[model samples]
Target: MADKAVDALSENEARDELARLSDLLARANRAYHAEDAPDISDADYDRLKRRNAEIEARFAHLKRQDSPSEQVGAAPAEGFSKVRHAVRMMSLSNAFDDEDIDDFDASIRRYLGLSDSDPLRYTGEPKIDGLSLSLRYEHGRLIQAATRGDGSEGENVTANARTIADIPDTLSGAPEVLEVRGEVYMSHADFADLNARQSARGGKTFANPRNAAAGSLRQLDANITRDRPLRFFAYSWGELTAPLAETQVQAIARLKDLGFQTNPLTSLCDGPEQMLAHYRQIEKQRATLGYDIDGVVYKVNDLGFQARLGFRSTTPRWAIAHKFPAELAWTRLESIDIQVGRTGALSPVARLTPVTVGGVVVSNATLHNEDYIAGRDSEGNEIREGKDIRVGDWVQVYRAGDVIPKVADVDLGKRPKDAKPFEFPTTCPECGSDAIREEGDAVRRCSGGMICPAQAIEKLKHLVSRAAFDIEGLGAKQVEQFYTDGWVKEPADIFDLKEKFGSGIQQLKNREGWGEKSANNLFDAIDERRSIALGRVIFALGIRHVGESASNLLARHYGTWSVFESAMLEAAPMEGPAWDDLLSIDGVGKVMAQSLVSAMNQEAERASIDRLVAHLNIQEAERPATDGSPVAGKTVVFTGTLEKMSRAEAKARAESLGAKVSGSVSKKTDIVVAGPGAGSKEKKAQELGLTVLDEDGWLELIGG
Candidate 1:
């Protein structure tokens, strides 16, 4: 019978690959549960949403009758108040290597069969990087809060989380509903006095403190999240109705007896060698703490062994995280310079003489290419061969963890040898052109993209940066005082700064710490960013393979900016599935598409994108799409462990969606979603037979 038609063509190719992995894991759970921004890489979208929940937990008659495995979060978004979570919140399993925290401590000592001497208490803490939310309460008064979405819906920001004072809003023994959860940060001395008053009112700052607490908790003005100091820590718990304690240290001493603030560096431990000695005494007091940690979570303290070791559909197989090995220091290089950028590259930098390591003060960093300033430092000596760092030597500096901080060893028997061997410049300090160095990379750049002037004032200070057009007055010290007073030079002279700073606003209202109510609050924060955000106009156009996670993956893959500038001016040569859909986008490679087609084939970078798209207004991106339709354009390609989203919101919802979300898997893949530890792009999309979906049939073919 020819084996019953080859088992009826392998059960109709497993029912058309479970209806294309439930339409690419319900369009990557409506681009990561009703989009805030994500496109893949939380290890390739948790290996195609854990192989679409292990093929809907092993073909429960081929699942998908509208499944994200019968969901939990994305429904109540329209204006808020949609409560139903009494306790499901979940989301916690990441380890990112150390063999995923020693296979999550040998799978909690093989599911509590326990081995070498029992006591395993654990605890640890400090994960923070903002915006998880939850908060509920009922008798404790603070009616709501929300935003974890898809762990069982979210986003009501109850009056901007009632302006967060460690989110109390009235508690003390008042429990009827509860909930709690946490992390809404912003500290490091209010992210350095909000980046020194957004650099003395020429606004636009805040690259961290979890993006100034998720842009001050999505403020449509809860008094701008009550004027932005915002802070919170309280860890875990998401639905009570009652039963307060029995440990997670008595539910963080009943969330500091219902007032909250919690994280006084948590602690407790007794096993996993005192949770790896309290993650090496919080990485040796992570540079005298006060905020921005990145890792050390731990947990376990037994809520009946985390309810008998439950949770695996995305982390909590009893908690882990770990992190650290990244903050190296040493100081004194004192001078090197170069810079340029907006695709002209030529970087170099150094400058040093400042210090403070992990908590900021880093006087000037990046020595990134010149084989990282001629190599060697964490003590094997040689920084330009022993202190020949020239312009005043003493070099060490490193910062390794969140990366970027080079110049490692250089003591050269602490030499000065009249410190010389200097001469690095091959030209283009600002615009003398000629820099060169191509043949297989180590940087060098500036063949003048936009006729130089320090690459048009570092591309108009990364197009009024602070995640772009955050333009208050225009800071980098007012774009180097409007490029040393010739008053702005490009990125459409920052929308002609209110007609050239309207006579430098009466000399910034008679100077000395300026007046006239802080120069009309820096002209109402540059007239509230003259309408922007297609991922801050593709991260204020500095381009060259872009950043801020490839400008939120090209504003969620061309949800506008004229269809991502007609696929970056594609006049031919982009081969196969449009070059495997622009190198299958997740953190893109091929040296970032040959530094974005050598900065759009130069001609002064196509006249600085036609003079910064003539005083900008290139918007479009808003897609959102979680259940109510729109994972934007679609093409998502993730791999293992994404229980519910956050590989930076699945590459910011595959770039707000016109679609092109790549990161390997080729022959022009249109959908390879995979997951449950998908390897080599699910074995090269099953040896090129291609289309392979999983992750709840990729959230029931995009309708999560």
Candidate 2:
């Protein structure tokens, strides 16, 4: 997993995580429900479940219909006869962050057609980390008890449940026929004693309280369950013959009066803020609560509203489970690997022995940087208890809510005899470039720029991006393939593709995916961009901090590539007037100028640029439209149907003449270029009273 938190997942990361979670959860379900053999512990399972919920919360649009969020426990373990529940014992949807809780409340109001000012009370209760059970009491007497197997049918644990003192055998002053639904759990103290007894008797010991409760309750022999410390908490009624109370809070009180054990923390909450504050309060008390609780469950207190909200396949829309953060576990660090990024930064990743933490099988964790591995931060503060991570060392991995697995601590006692301190590489692993760290920088970067194979591939990809060179038929995939085959290594190689392959001796047409026509078309496309704007050329270089705006500043300030190149070369050695001129440009910073000067001063790099310059006619950047005739140095927005030229043609024409083409109309907009069916932008421009021009008006003003 990446070291980023769930909130930081990129689109690709989110999509990949969705697929990984789907496959993992599916396998876990098959192992636990279908085979009656759990491959992961209960705490681990809960961790995975919470992680999926948080990921889904952040990326709701990416949620799959067959998601684990819609699934309860695996289909009643295929053993004892299944007891179909009268009322579906559904699972609760989760709320990972405070925003989710607010969204839930807002959704309830929107669905009920209630305004924000309207009060909607909810009952907040502990989400016990245990197995769900449904106890049916007929005519004020307990008739049967079952597990919440698949939410529809469950394994009959009536005999086993009867051994728990918390579960009442009979009920007085209760509904004639009522099915009480709650959790079967083991307290911390009791669980510890039970594990001790099991160890003394040479029996299997559980990993946690939840596992012990589940294993004890699922026993075929009631005598075996009687010996284990099992407890129950009645929270809600599944199938009631008559009304227990008008509100959820009253019902919980009634369940308690009927001699059923209920969670004492269950209270009516006013709103999302109150619920979240209570959740934090519960979390603070979790360690000393005796019984384990994974999260806090909130249900609409009003019975009528709850009925109206009802269920959605497996969970009620009226209730949600706000889960705690994931747990940490110790695992062996098998090895450490370095992954080079597009920016030529070498990132260290720890290769683990496929240990499961919190439910997800993690094979990798981020070592952050060389400092993190050496047990210190960039600021030289002690980290991981001043223990440097080494291969074959036992390390504590914490998932928390981060999508990226983090190395929380190191277990020096479990450190292997052969373990050695990792030596961080000082050279570019890919191209053997001199990797150096500047003062006050956390990471050491390769000084190779675009010469390094890794940096060249990344720059090539960026060179064809919309804001840069944007060469047709030379996308990311084609660039990577050509670079791998030695046909292309730098941005200039793109312009040389035709001459090298035009000969019949080594034709590009012979390539697997290329033909004569396609190859010719690619060459034609390359020829079309021989005369490129100076700003685009600078941006295409991918100099560290020289972005589109910075490149434009340099291009406009210098006017031509030769002037900019001469100034950068002259300023490279020291902080002189030539460097001051670069820093004087608007949007140009000292760091950006430093990077530009550094790149232009490299001997190997200058040679490569000279070769590219020989192949093309570099255009001088135009003076701002503000200082010239119309639309010069001014922000121009284009919208609607253009009859004279395509949108791309209009944007190119405007940018060529020093007019900034903006996507949206704002107060800074100098002019609005509207077409046949102009919308909000044109209207906003008109309201702002900025110069509004039609297609023909714009064409006339620009002399197009």
Candidate 3:
């Protein structure tokens, strides 16, 4: 597949290639954009996308509906409230080399019906390798900040954005309404310092500055974001009440004047040659820029020209991102090692002969999964030309603004004579439990559950995490020590620590690094957390696929732990009213429901939960303050197309008014807002005798 050119491919091959490309690109998007962790290099991703586009061009009729070419970024990640952008945030077209730049210029000229000699000024700015953010301001005050999700909607991160020193809380002399778009970035020095601190504290360190910036900005807690040094550079606008300027350069100047940071290297270029020159200049200074930038962006100078050029489905025709070449080097694959995660995922790591990539020394790289090592995708499609990797083989390691290097290509010709295809282990490397690869799952997982030491230790760490019990003086290090000493093996064991090790022969104060004061403090902290909120309690359990937001949703829906536990026990059979009710919660899916039920029904797990419960007081989830709103505490369902606002916007508004927004209509549904084309849900609501309202009625009732 790698040897075959797009022009030489048959229709069937092209179709298969398209499918492979779509899946790879989609996963890459989620990894990079949503998770802030990229498994593939930018150069490799670009090559796959280019190949997909070329194949689609050759076989237009074979283009899949879920083509990567038609998509923007991945959908907004869960746990955060969603924000619908007033003006869609579009991505830019890419230009790889001088020829591509020339083609881009030519295309713009052709679209404008102008000759090559005609005057067309462009603005070139360094494309910062960071997260895209949109800040909405009203009446000169910053109101909301959101990430660039799927172009249409994004995650609301207003509190986190407010903590960045580079962003102004209130803009003076700005438009009545303005939506400033920029890149949230971390400087190399700051990123290095932050990583150093994280490593010292036994916390997770990011691989690169871009990931650090994104991870920081998207933190659930703003105080954590405030601690991380983040910066922003405004380069564009989204929604505006009035025009800022007639040209792009003037608009940027106005933004800077309004107290927003703008990239200083931005310059006006008369044509493609100047743009290329600026790009080369930026490339030359990239190493010394103090910040990470992957490319240079060229945009039409005149706002009028931009308006005339408009946009493609997901990209703007008036702008292009000319990416820099990836840094790559040859390295030897010394060995393959499997590491078991808390979720029982057997992740493969490639121990490499030490080499340098992108000015960083690399001794390791991510092998992604067993399928990737075997040169195949999840669907058995060929990858890396179906060349499997083996120990003692020469591999091409690539680093593209990622902390960890990746083996992009293997030199099969340079393979060692005795090298053999690596066999992935069929059992957990840590606990000797059988590893199973479920249907549709890319990675094989250990089925040992709580019996596995790795899973048990990680779950114990999670139980005391900041979002869970958050016991002071008890962190990952303490958890690991306690687990290794056999003082704490499960959640219930944590509660018995005082009685077991507080005095006599097994005294905790006598342990290394533990003075009497510190030991007392730790015990006090554990005791203080004996009573916890229901959401935190649920999250602390570390159920598969159930996150903080889902925990909260379940807590709100069930109200009490006894009721929730009883319901889960009833739903263990996986049917009837209890199961239906569990599935009725907006975000609860079948997989999560099953996981919850199984955890509750399992003998050992249930006994451990009950034991832990006997020692603690769990508070009911707090309801949102109604603030005199009419729909407060009511359950509302919005079905079909919403005319006044997007579904995300409507849901956000309803939630803000203290109304619960459910995806399905059930007996608990208090109101149903049905728009045009509303069918099943509307009819179901009518059948259930639930109050139904049209779009206009919904708007009127909410006083929107």
The best candidate in terms of lDDT: 3
Model 2 over residues 1-704: C-alpha lDDT tens digits? Answer: 32236876765566555544554565466555444445444434555676787887887655543467766666555235578899888877777789989999998997777899999999899889777889999988887899887677788888998899999998888778999989888888998899899999999977667667888988888999999888899898888879999999999889999998899999789999899889988999987888878789999999999987766657888999887877787888888987665667777888888766653456777675787788885556676668999999998887632133667788898888888899998998988988886554556678776678888887787787545775666777788989989988876788887777656224687887788777877788788889899988887776655555567767876789889888988898758778665554433545456667887887887788777778888899977544565666777888899887666568867877777776667677888889989999899999999999999999999986
RMSD of each: 28.2, 19.4, 9.9
Q: What TM-score against the true fold does each predicted structure earn?
A: 0.27, 0.49, 0.66
How many steric clashes between backbone atoms does each model show? 70, 4, 1
lDDT of 3 by residue, 361-393 (tens): 568777867988999876677899889999998
Better of 2 and 3 by lDDT: 3
lDDT against the true structure, per candidate, is: 0.62, 0.76, 0.85
Error of 3 at 197 (Å): 18
In candidate 3, where is summed lDDT lowest over 10 consecutive residues? 501-510
Clashing pairs in 2: 2-404, 625-632, 625-633, 626-632
Supply the TM-score for candidate 1.
Answer: 0.27
lDDT order, best first, reads 3, 2, 1
Q: Who wins the TM-score comparison?
A: 3
